[model samples]
Structures are given as C-alpha cells and as structure tokens.
Target chain A: MDMATMNKLMECATFANCYPRDVVFRQGDPATHFYSVLSGYVRLFRQNSEGREADIRVCGPGDSFADELIFGGDTYEYHAQAADKAMLARYDINRVRNAAQADDGMLARAIAGSLAGQLQETMDCIANDRLNTAVQRVALYLLEQAEGQESPASFRLAFQKSLLAGKLGLAPEALSRAFATLKGLGVHVHGRIIEIEDMDALRAL
Target chain B: MDMATMNKLMECATFANCYPRDVVFRQGDPATHFYSVLSGYVRLFRQNSEGREADIRVCGPGDSFADELIFGGDTYEYHAQAADKAMLARYDINRVRNAAQADDGMLARAIAGSLAGQLQETMDCIANDRLNTAVQRVALYLLEQAEGQESPASFRLAFQKSLLAGKLGLAPEALSRAFATLKGLGVHVHGRIIEIEDMDALRAL
Candidate 1:
C-alpha cells in the first residue's frame, strides 16, 4: 500500500482501447490474463441452458476481472464484455507471479483484495436472490448502485435494463413490475437513470 | 511444495477432534480461520427462510474450507458442519498473513494454490449446474466421487442421499430419478456405494 509499490503496479499495466460492446473474454475461453478497467463499464455474465445470458456481475472504472487465472487456471467460466467505450489495462499472468515474488505487500493485497471482492459480490448476489422479494431486490440494488456511483440520491445505470434484470436474476417482466413497485414507493426512474427520493427508505426496503 | 514447508504449515495449524453432526461454524460466525480436513467429511450449507438447508459443498479428507475471509470479509456466508466423525486442522489467518510477509514462495504458492483450488471447485459447481443435464449432474458427480475415492466401481456414500441431492441442487425425488437413470446406464448402487460400469457413457451424458 506504499507509494512506490502502488506506482509500480500502475506502471506494470498499460492502457488499451476497446470499442463499445467488444467482447473481452467469453465463457469457456482460456483465462490467460487479469484485467483492470481504467475507464468504462464491463459486464461479466454467463449463458443459461435456455440460451439466455445471465449477467453475473459488472465492473466499472477501477475494478478488476479474470482473477480465477491469477494463480493458474485454463478456462474462463464467465463472459466479460465492454459495456461502453473503454480503457482497460491488462497484466500478464507471469508479471503478476513475478510481482508476488518480489515481496510486495501491496501487490499481494491487490490480488487478495480482487478475489475477495468478487467472492463477496457473488455471495451477495446469491443471498439477495434467496433472502429478498423482487421489490427488495430492486430497492437494495438501487441503493448499491447509488453507493457505487458515490451519489446517494441520483445515478445512472451502466448497463441495459435487460442486463440489470439478468444481474438481479429476475425476469424482464418481473423487473418491470419491480420498477412499478419502486414507483409506488416514491422512487423515480427515467430510462437508465434512477433518482432515489430517500436512500434510507430504499435501504430499509 | 517441499516437505519442510508442508511441515511448517502443518505445525502452524492446530488440530481438533469432532463428533458427527457437530457444528464447525455457523453461517454468521466471524471467519478468523480456515480449516483443512485431516479426516472424515465436512458439509457446508446455507439455510433458507423455510428452514430448508441447501448444501453448497462437501469436503472430505485433504480438503479445505473457509478461504472467503482472506479477501477482507467479516463473517462466513455459509455453515460448515461435520458430516461424520472428523479430525480437522485449523490455521490462524494472522499466522498465514505473517508468513506471506516473509516473502516465502512456498507459502505464497500454498496460499495461491489453496485459493485457486477453491475457485476451481466453485467454477466446476457453476458449470455442472449450468452445462450438465439433470442426469449428467448425477453422473458427473458420481464420477468425481469415484475419482476422489479411488473406487469408481464401488464406494460408500459418506452421507445421506438427501444431503447429496442438496449439494447437486436437485430435489430428493430428482436425485432418486437420477440414480435410477444411472442404474439404467449400468451404474450399480446399493445403499450409498455406487458402481459405474461405463465411465465413457457417464461422461458422454
């Protein structure tokens, strides 16, 4: 977490351009590298038997992905796609391995923190799916979005509505109904942007 | 891993004896340590609102559990319980952290390998749930059990049939039908021990 080690980690990963909607990696592909999103939104998802894409998670600016390969893994279990015009930094697996060898707590922390974050997010997704109703899921997700955006009352959704529904494990119709429920509870939505009237009430829901 | 490092790791972890059905840790308990199965079986599960328990995973000899806390999480997200009379080795998180601070490649590899193995197992679970048919789930799971037990043709089931069903995310009835399907494909089952007559056919399913 010191300044020199932080600078070194930043230097090790170089920015690369990505077209909007480009596929970074697809499910079942070989997982060869780890990626950090310097700018833009990235959607991570998997396909179901019905051929519907289930959005597992999304990474916006500063978030990392493809951590399963960091130690050593051959196949990618999820699909990662660019959600918008993006700048991403890719790190070679060997570089990371070598960095870990150099006795850097910051790098180790970064790797551990990245995996931990993904695990937490995944557990949260599964828990919310099990513990809350459709309305609560929507309310909780909205509050999370507000937190992620660093704006408690207003923020824009990074992905499409259908993708959001998939991320929440809800059918599109259920998502629409949840939106109606939010409206009944005084939360406002316009296209992909949501304006939360009372963050406390949303969290309580 | 070298013998010396393995010995050191084993030395740092404390050992304990446990009875069948003993609670290793509850769902909301603080996750200050990780456990390695020294002997017998351990079952990890999550309970639903209806008090129905869904088995998330099972660990037998040489298997480890509770790596989620390594990433900065506060509490365990699942319950870990002894599936049978067991011996377990518990490792303190702080000890491992201090070991990593010493920049030991062996220790780093140990931690990385452990984390990677958990991630691999998780991916397999998701893939089995996603890519396999109901019959295939049972077949694949049986095959894995066969490999783990070193007896594909005949091995005793360590836990009840219902518990296995929960781990596979199938209803007991569905798991019964799956067993029947395996039998139809020439797999033999008596109580818990299963014998596979055709590994290729099982894999093909």
Candidate 2:
C-alpha cells in the first residue's frame, strides 16, 4: 500500500486494546470491521462440536485478520483471540470499501493481494496436510520458521507446542516424535527454543 | 454485478474454447487473467509427486476460478482442466482491476465477495477433512448436493464417481462403502443418479 492509502486507512481506523487471551471475536459474530494487529499476536481458529479446536493462522504485527469477511456475508465463520496484550486498528468495512472504490485501483489491488496471499497460504496448508508425512511436515515447518535467516540460525516457537501441533494437524505426541526424528538433521529442540545446526540437511528432508 | 458493470466486464473479456480433458492452465503458469466458465465444466486440482491427484473444486457455468492469483504473485498455484467441452471467458486482470477501482465500491465489493466465498469454502474443506469421519463427510456431501431441493428429491452427480470421492477425501472403495451405508437412510444411488428418499433422515446424519 502507498503512503496515501495507508494514511487514509489509518485516518478512518479506530483503536482497541486487548489483554492477553482476550477473545476478539467468536464464530458467528457480526463482522462490521476488519482488524490489523498494531502490536502483539492474534490466533484465528475454529472448534468442532466435540470442542476440539483447530488453529487456523496466527497474525503478528502489521498482519490483518478477517478481512475476507469484508467481501462475504456479515458474520464471522471462525474465532479470534488475542495471543498477547495487544493493540489493534479496526477499519470500518464500509469506509474501507468506499475508499477502495474511490481509488485508482491501488486499494483494490492491495485488498486482492492480501486475499490472494491468504488463499495461497491456506491451499499450501491443505496440500502439506494431505501430501507430507508428520516428520516431513515438522521439518518443513522448522525451515519455514528459519526462513530469511543465515544457516545454523535459531528461533523461538511463536506459539505453544500443542497449538503448533494443532496447526500441523498432528497429535501432540506425534509432534514430539517428529521433533525427535528431526534431531537427525541437527534440529535441537529445548522447550520453546529451537536451533538448526544443519539447515541444509533439514531442507533436504 | 449490475448491467453496466457486466457489460464493461464482457467488453474486456476474450473467449476460449476447450475440448473435453483439455488443460486450461497448469500449476506454475503465469496468471495473466482470471477465467469464468461460460459453458460446461472445469476441474481445479493438485497432484503430488507420486502422481496422486486431489480434486479441489469443480466449476460449472457462471462460476469463476483463478481469482486468488489476481491479488498475489503472477503464477498459478494449481492445475485447471476442462471436465467437459467448455467455453470460458478470460478477463484481463489489469483492466478488471482498474474498472473495479473506478466503480462505486460495487465492483470492488463483488471481487471481495468472490474471494471471501472461495476462502470460506476452502476453510470449510479443511475443517471437514480434519473433523469429520469418512461416512460423515460423504453424508454431509450428499446433503450439500441436495441443498436447495425439496425433500425426497433426486439429482445427478455433477462429475464422475471417482472425482466425487476425491472431493470428499475418500478412497474409491471407501466412497462405495459410504454409499452402501447411506442406503439405510433411504439414499438410493444408481450409478451417477442419486435419489434422496428421506432428506430428513440424511440430514439427521
């Protein structure tokens, strides 16, 4: 987005503060505004009748959630919760829609870009779930987390191991086994911190 | 879309004819345009290295595909093939983007609506894959197919039985077994045609 559009969006935005673990919205809530994370994290998810939850996506700073609802029906189909004490900017859907309409395609293109990126991510998730083994999925996820870093770099897990397991469509014990298997590629996991001793070998998986 | 917007869109559209089983576009092709099925059917899918294929969606007349590529990088992420002899209208992405930008928020809203609908469908697919049993999934699929019909109605399968099985994330044999099990609920399957003798009983599943 250009500075002009960004400024216009920010100008119409309202701010909200949420404590850690705050429920931002629940499934079936009216979707009147689209939210951007100004600080901290938000987790999007859905629960089955058995009350088992599936983690959809985690949004950090500058990332937005539920923007798809802007174009669809008036209600949310999933739940969102603040993963940290966070500040968010909520843009009224109508205002944003009107602004995009008035623009010379920049805002519309941006909106399209956001949706496209999200759709691609979801598609990739589905593909991985269907095509990859549990160990391969865990290894690939580590590589993704270590993306853009120098070889042999390390990082902390963004969310809990159990939640990560949910996102990867694996049982927690299965994720533990995957981590144990990844040790062969020099992935060292000590609680939330992980160190990649051989990034290339991990990538080879 | 209104008549004016529809006329504008059609003015920028080019037509393509496809034979049965024709490859409309392959994974990784440049996504220069989004396509609408003017007649017949198109199948969107992904294939693994083992040559196994997963059916993503089947688009019939009036439906669109590849809209997700409009917002992100200019490359197709999935394969599209004609399920039947088909006619498609391709709209230049840049022209559509510009026209949407100039509209009174209606065109942009329409585009957003399309993306949102696709996203929701994909999300639901994921949820169903993760949460439902094979029998439940097949039963739910039948209910979805029977949607908009009066009770005890019948409808022909839109695609082949194998394709329907793939869409429901079941093996061909498993799908057959599911069909057999569903007979108890008064779902009579005779090859491609299915008769729902008791819609309420199927829904009760």
Winning model by lDDT: 2
Say which candidate scores most in TM-score.
2
Whole-model lDDT, candidate 1?
Answer: 0.74
Minimal lDDT window, size 10, model 1 chain B = B123-132
Per-model TM-score versus the true fold: 0.81, 0.89
lDDT of 2 by residue, B1-205 (tens): 7888688788779999999899999888888889999998898878776776777777888788887765556878788999888999998887876777676656665676777777777777777777777878988888888899987889998878877776776779999998989888888988899999888887666
Model 1 bad stretches (over 4 Å): A27-30, A46-55, A104-106, A126-136, A146-155, A171-174, A177-189, A195-205, B47-53, B103-105, B130-136, B146-158, B180-188, B195-205
Error of 2 at A74 (Å): 1.7
Interface DockQ per candidate:
0.30, 0.49
In model 2, how large is the Cα lDDT of residue B50?
70
**Residue A49 in model 2: shift from native, Å?**
3.5
Q: Chain A TM-score of model 1 versus the true structure?
A: 0.84
